[model samples]
Target: MSELTTLARPYAVAVYKRAKETGTADKWSDALAFVTLLMQDEQLAKAAANPKANREQFSEAFLGLCKDHLDTEAQNFVRLLIRNRRLDLVKYIAELFNQYKAEDEGYIEVDVSTAFPLKDAEQARLSSVLERVLEKKARLRVDVDPTLIGGVYIKAGDRVIDASIRGQVERLAKRLWT
Candidate 1:
């Protein structure tokens, strides 16, 4: 995972910089997503790995698969990826591009794992508190996990707040075992 991220970072950064400069982050987001999906096709992967595949032919086929979804800029981006033989990195590029777009839009996406579903009022209060604490617009994605036992597990970027009952019990067990 880390290796893929490291390899994809430069491409993601370059594309993001171009999109940021041209005010087309949203467009690039859609383009990258589309291309990423296309690259996931088994036939496409086989063609990409074929040493005999002509670059022009591969690029045209890729662009054709996309139909009218991509614009000229996006078409050129696809061609560049083909020329560089980096279609395998498209997924990571799209992920990083979305991350960049969220940061630009002042959005912080967080995941919340709770033992039970949250009520409307509870969700609202949690969002409000998270927004205040994170100092960015909080977008919460909640999941019910019975194994959590109680409380919540909140993850935002590299930070994780594991206040779940299972987490506490595990910590206590570890201390006692040590």
Candidate 2:
């Protein structure tokens, strides 16, 4: 995981820079998503790895698959990836690029896991509190986990606040044993 992330960092940075300069972060996001999906297709992987495949052949096949979705700049980006044999890195590159873009835009992707489904009012209140605490716009993705017993666990980037009853019980048991 770390190695893939290391290999992907430079590509992500370069793409982010270009996107920032051209005001096309959203476009790049869509392009990267398309490429990432293409990379996931088994047939495409076989084609990409074929010993007989040349850059032109690969690019033609790839572009043909994406012709309807990508613009010229996106096509050039795909060509560059093919030329550099970096098509395999598309997923990691897209993930890292989105991370960078989110940071640049002062937005945080947060995961909130609750014991049960959240009502609209509850979700709105949580969002309000999170926005205030994080001091930025919060893009919250919520999930339900009955095993949590009660309360919620919130993860924002590298920070995690585990307020679930299950978590508290585990911590208390550990303290008692120690």
Candidate 3:
């Protein structure tokens, strides 16, 4: 995972820069997301890995399938990936590109895990609190983890706020053992 991100970062940065210069960051975001999903398809993965699959044919088929979503610049980007056999990096590239986009837009992506699903009001309240504390808008990726027992665990960038029941119990146990 780290290797892929390291390898894909330069390309992702290049794409993001181009999109920013062309004033098409949002469009490129959509195109990259579509391409990433297309590349993840089982059949496409098999074809991409097959030594016998004609590279030209595979490239044409992929472009044709995504014709509606891609513009000229996006088509060229896809071609570059295909030519370099870097299609596998599409997912990482999209992720990195999204990170760049979020930073440019002055927001941070956060992952929140809870024992139960949060209500809309609960989510909004949490978002408001996080934004106030973090001093940036928060884009949350929420998940339910029954093993958490109760409360919430939030991860934003390099910071973690673990208020889960399991986390509290672990801390108390560690202190007692020490």
lDDT of 3 by residue, 42-70 (tens): 99988876777788888899899999999
TM-score of structure candidate 3: 0.84
Which of candidates 1 and 3 is the stronger one according to lDDT?
Answer: 3
Best by lDDT: 3
Off by over 4 Å in 3: 165-178
* lDDT (10s digit) by residue, model 1, range 93-168: 8988878888989998889999999998999999999999999998899999999999999998778999999999
Arrange candidates, best TM-score first.
3, 2, 1
Question: What are the per-residue Cα lDDT tens digits for candidate 2 across 48-126?
Answer: 7676789898899889999998999889888887888878888999989988998999998889999999999999899
Report residue 147 deviation for candidate 1 (angstroms): 5.5
Models sorted by lDDT, best on top: 3, 2, 1
Measured against the true structure, the TM-scores of the candidates, in listed sequence, are 0.76, 0.77, 0.84
Point out the higher-scoring one by lDDT: 2 or 3: 3
> Distance (Å) between predicted and true CA of 49, model 3?
2.8
Give the lDDT of residue 120 in candidate 1.
Answer: 89
